[model samples]
Target: MPIDIRGSSASEIADSLRALVERGGLRPGDALPPVRTLAESLGVNRNTVSAAYRQLTIAGLVVTLGRGGTRIAGQAPVAQEGFADTVLRDVGTGNPDPSFIPDPSRALATIAGRPILYGEPVIDPDLERWAQEWMSADLEPASLRLTITSGAADAVERLLAQALTREDAVALEDPCFLASIHTVRMGGYRAVPVPVDEEGMTVDGLRAALAHGVRAIVCTPRAQNPTGASLSAQRAAALREVLGEHPYVLVIEDDHYSMLSRTDYHSLIGPEHRRWALVRSVSKFLGPDMCLAVTASDPETAQRLALRLTPGTTWVSHLLQRLAHALVTDPDARDRVDAAAEHYAARNAAFAELLTAAGIPVRAQDGLNLWVTLPVPARAVSEQLMRRGWLARTGDEFDLVPAGPSHRLRLTVHDLSDDDAGQLAADIAASVRAVA
Candidate 1:
């Protein structure tokens, strides 16, 4: 059956197509008529049909495959960064151990104050001052402006939205953070895969992405997700040199694991770089419920980002901001945070030893999880582990561009007991051999 695309105006046509999707008249993978065919049938101009298609694509209702034509988007669920719902032991959950997170009770008591009214400053003054000093240590003494958002993910989404329009190309790390992938796809932006190696985004991969005409780049400077790769000083300098050719490209460095990361920060932003933002969130140390992140960016980018974050409507709550500041500033809470970093590193290191002893040679890196390379395909070993009551996240789930079968597994084993960790290591070794 043909799609009855009925309407004279762009808005009307978009509404008509949306209705078809809502009513199940058009299903996922169902292709819409060509622009000329739809325009001729509806007695409208080709521009009107094109506008309608653009509207649907931006709304994530349809996908344009260029010469292949537009089709209804499948709406597949994007994988998240937290715990997975499972009865089995979930080693794939990219979560900080609860015991390590600092207690918020003391800070909560100190945050009570007069209710903030609309039109008052968006960011808490104390928080703003502290954040400036914190970010300044890592950044050059340029004209830096600060903006606070709900979290690092929210900051990235808004930063990209302010910088680029729909279909604009963005350079993303291949095997990227799940949230970044979802944000780019939902905004209808093209993601140019920049491969990440042990030292972070490869210089050649970044050059290729730039050559592909990417308008923006999102990279994790330290403790990169899944792979736990950090940019070494040498690699960071090389990346900065490559980016020098495209100084105006919007570079967003999501330093999400800021406080908890054991590695030193190696910045990709050069002293003379024109556009960039470094985002650090309080979620990892203060607990995920403390939804706040501080972003330091070039003055102009900060101004553009502020447009989306209004005084009262969209600005992050001042109370939350104060709470985060109090916790971070307190000596006891700061000590707890430092301990948490050490705790995570030690746990991961111990687990790596366990894996090595079990016949699978492994080395621990930064971040809360271990990115293990298996002798066999990760999916096959994952399946074998599933039979032994364990849930695992394979490397393919994070791949921006599907290569062949992935041989890596991202395991969150930091919170497991010593016995459990040893058992899991042995089980993983068995699973690899079983699937080999």
Candidate 2:
């Protein structure tokens, strides 16, 4: 057969050619028909046919050997330009809106400690007692134990180090927090991406991951990155059901936005699930520089994690811990922090509303940012925004699987003033339209 090439446009024709290649009819060295003949046969304009052919050539799927006609190449198409160290922006990162974080002066007032001698335990007893209380909220099970660490990122690294080997597969949300993905690459581990949905990690994706023999999973149950999808209570229960049968799999829950999260905690770790850790970092609400995360896990796993902490880096900063404890426990600080969480949620929602009003689709469940769908490629839109004097991160940078052209963009709406947000909305609308 001459390869079925019926499709809507130039891109579709290119896709049809790829399909032929996949079906084995268009193997290496298989020369395609002349452009004019193919265009006539398909009832499309010759320029449309030419564009498709050019695209296929660019993809390396076909090569025009001078007048010898186009032949399938040994390789496939090259991926178009991808994330090149995405620019830091006023948008994208899911950090707490700084205005809401309470400045804790009391911790500094009590800060007085000499360098510890060798073999000294790392954590402060006072902080430990308070952490036990602080951690109790997220990890409600009495059997679960708690340990302090530098941050949620640190906790993830140490847990992965303890459980998996070099190059072992670990499942993570495809558009996960960059840190977790970076942790996998930096630790020389292969990442098995589980697709996320509006309710966070999909069950089928999880099943595929388990079947793929992923020994570790890093999930952010609530406030998942990029997409801002939180796992529903029912979804959490379903995941726990699947995980229950896999006792040996190490589940790490990174609740990085704990204090700033306006959602309830949900866990895929069943009551009987043996190995798991719920990492709640105070860095978000308390401030990133605070650098302390409460790592709560099962007693045995917590002890193993403690061993990783060791005598040298024995525990988290006692000063940081004390600060976290004081701030979390203080009524005024707690109120301010809660208000900050609400502030982030409100700002994101308002921005999403503004975008929608401007004909740009957007929705974010509960997070420091909003996921927006534009009318054209988000990367192009972000580049335009950069020219407009606002740096923005392209969502493609955080996605694991390659997404075809999309208008999706993640906007960190927190910290934007009314005027700034209005201006951003107007600019973004103009940019998307310009690209489209």
Candidate 3:
């Protein structure tokens, strides 16, 4: 059996490959012909083959493994989190320290309820009321509607499902949230890379993505993952202006860190944007087990999302929703959440200062993890750190493109004590210097 590339153009080659994949001729993990061999056999330019391969990669259909060559991507990789299962110091897990998460035992006891029948309202009244106030405080004047889902990831999946079709182009940060990357790739959508800087997603990047005809844009306005970059007020306003021209394109702001973020929420959803969703999950502030997120969006989007989460078949559990409401409203719980927020900021900042002193010059802008730029490629540095009995996440894990080797690492060292932080910083500096 051979690939039919006789008179195919770049996109035609991509289409043929996609069809083969769909029909099961080319299985996951199956190897494609080498680029030079395929090009020569097909009587096509090598650049055309390269472009076709690039398309396949963007569509999440195949992956290039350096000298290992290209192979069909088996399945969407589960975004690893909060520590890999290993003996080394687990700094890669982007999870909040268990000690900082407030105990939900009391809230569990308070959630007394009768059996929730299929016809009952999906969202708890109390939870809805609280969410309205919480979301309204940050939004500009608009006709908004509320919807609840299992978590931010669930909300994003549903939002995209309702608004776009498979194979639609979606704009995502280059080094993006794992969940976002996983969601887009698993949905079989084309991911367009938008670069991020210290201030946040770049205006030019967004413009380029929009120019490429992206149907939806997923943005992390504050406490962006991996990099800890937050959208500054100026940056947000500039993005809003660029987006003003594309009012109908769907914009999803995943404010997953929400109350736990030290930076202010600078939203990218402009007032005139017709289709949008702002999702805030309680997992970070309250606890991951709570499994509830509040989404405020245009009424039309809310109505569409509701159709997917009807009462009987797939609504989020009312018990979970009520417990989340109870804990969030409790004064003690609120105070503890606030304290946890402060603690994360302080710990990350302190560790960053130590790294800077060691000549690494890293700073944690915001979020539970610190994104450290290494003097060498992050993978090499991470390998050296492993020799030192430390584990960390390299930035390449979050990239949307196979651009090059990553030069950064995402670390969850905030849970370490001051002495441990100093030692880790020294180890990291040494590892980088060694690798370089």
Candidate 4:
């Protein structure tokens, strides 16, 4: 059955289309008529039809796929970060080992204080002080302002919301972090993919994205997800030079693996850049339940971000902030965090050696997961592993371009025991050979 769209004006047409979607007259992936055709049928100007499409696009009721034409937006599932639900030996979970997380019990006692009232400061004073010193080490102290959010994901979402409007272009890593991809799509912003290599986002890729008129760039300086790529100092410098020309572009650096990373932090935000933010979350070190991240940005951006975090309604729980501050600052807790970092690096290195010996050569990088390149498609290898009593995540799930089957796998083997790790390595080798 054809969609019975009925309207004369843009608002009327948009309302009609929305009603159709709500009533199931037009389903997801169902394309609307061409602008000229729709306008001719409705006896309206072509601009009127185009305006109607824009309204629907902004409302996220429909999607405009360039030459592919506007269609009802599909309700696709967003990829998540955490454990997969399965009885098989799950190695694809993008989670830090629970054993390595610092115990928050001692820190809990230290955070006991009077009940925080609505009129009180949004950020805990002690936490604010500590965050200032920490962020100031890398960001310019003279202009830095801090804001606290639920996590890095929250910060990025709000930052993009404040900096850009719907449908604005944002540059993201090609095999981007799941949260970033989801955030961009849900905000109705366009994502321009910037390719990543062993040294993080490529300079040429960034240049092309900027040339494409991207208003914002989300970068991972270290421990880039799935790939475990860190930004090399040389690459960072080159990126900075390119970004120097576009000082007004909003640059958000999510240093999610800050404390756990083995590499130095190389920022893409230049000192003279006008709008930028650096977000560092404690989830990787303190545990994910902590739900806290600190953002340092220029004074103006911080002020705009502050608008979304109202004092009485949207402020992060002071108790949570205090606990995070205590744990991150305590000597014993710091020691545990340091040991955890070492444990991750050591475990990943050992697993890499085992993989090499199993004929799948890989080198350990600075993240919780290993990005393994295989001889055959990763989905095929993953299926083979499942048959062998294992579960894994294929790389295509992380791709922004959707270029068909991927030859890579992201395995989280840090928590596995020596015996279990060795078995997994052998199984992966066997799976790859079977698929190849």
Q: Please give the RMSD to the true structure for each candidate, in Å.
A: 3.2, 12.1, 3.8, 2.6
**What's the CA error at residue 414 for candidate 2, in Å?**
1.6
Candidates ranked by TM-score: 4, 1, 3, 2
In the range 1-436, model 3's lDDT, one tens digit per residue, is 2865444698888888888888888888888899999988888999999989977886678989888899988876577666577889978888887888888889989898898986788889999999999998888747899999989988999899888876789999979998888888778688899999999899999999999999999999988998889999999999999999999999999998998988888999888899999999999988787788999999999999998776424778888888899989999989999999999999998898999999999877888999998878999999989998899899989987757899989999878987888889999999988977
Model 1 scores what on Cα lDDT? 0.91
Q: Judge candidate 1 at residue 327 and give its lDDT.
A: 90
User: C-alpha displacement of 299 in model 3, angstroms?
Assistant: 0.3
lDDT over C-alpha atoms for residue 92 of model 3: 85
| Tens-digit lDDT string for candidate 4 (6-47) | 899998999999899999888999999999999999999999
Candidate 4 Cα errors over 4 Å, as ranges = 6-16, 29-31, 34-36, 43-74, 311-313
In model 1, the clashing pairs are none
Worst 10 residues of 4 by lDDT: 307-316
lDDT (Cα) of model 3: 0.88
Tens-place lDDT digits, model 1, residues 106-167: 88899999999877888899999999999999997378999999999889999999999877
Work out the TM-score per prediction: 0.90, 0.77, 0.89, 0.92
Model 2 clashing residue pairs (backbone): 59-77
**Every candidate's lDDT:** 0.91, 0.79, 0.88, 0.91
Better of 2 and 3 by lDDT: 3
